[model samples]
Target: MRSPRRGNAFEQAEAAFKAATKKNEPMPKAPVTPPAGKEMVSLRLDRDVLAHFQDDGPGWQARINAALRAAAGLDPA
Candidate 1:
């Protein structure tokens, strides 16, 4: 006796095409906020200077920002 076939190639291709073209539920919108007046820029510093700031582990970037602000005579926020 011959074994029963699972599905034909055309049927499998149609099912796959339908599944691929199916639309998913839309994602919910997130709250929008105004910019905080900060702009991203590229800066180069000495290896030792960067290492000094980074040695403290976390918040090294914040520390660098604070130090720069202090050097520039700007008041802390």
Candidate 2:
């Protein structure tokens, strides 16, 4: 097999695991309301905050969401 094809297969497997785990987990029992279809909004945070997130690379947005959830007294995991 080609090298690129092998890399793609590994990526596909990783994605599959993520989806499977997400599906296997029990759903939160908060009356089933979710914040979907929300528009992307920009905010001006402090330089340190921005730097902290940028250093995390990809999925930084998800980290931000988790932080927001925690701030709102909601469970992030």
Per-residue accuracy of model 2 over 19-61 as CA lDDT, tens digit each: 8877555867877553686557888889999779879799887
The C-alpha RMSD of each candidate to the native structure, in angstroms, is 4.7, 16.0
Please state the error at residue 55 of candidate 1 in Å. Answer: 0.4
Model 1 over residues 1-77: C-alpha lDDT tens digits? 98987699899899999999999998998877535976677899999999999999998988998899999989655
The C-alpha local distance difference test score for the whole of candidate 1 amounts to 0.89
Candidate number of the best TM-score? 1
User: What's the TM-score of every candidate structure?
Assistant: 0.53, 0.46
RMSD of 2: 16.0
Backbone clash count, each prediction separately: 0, 0
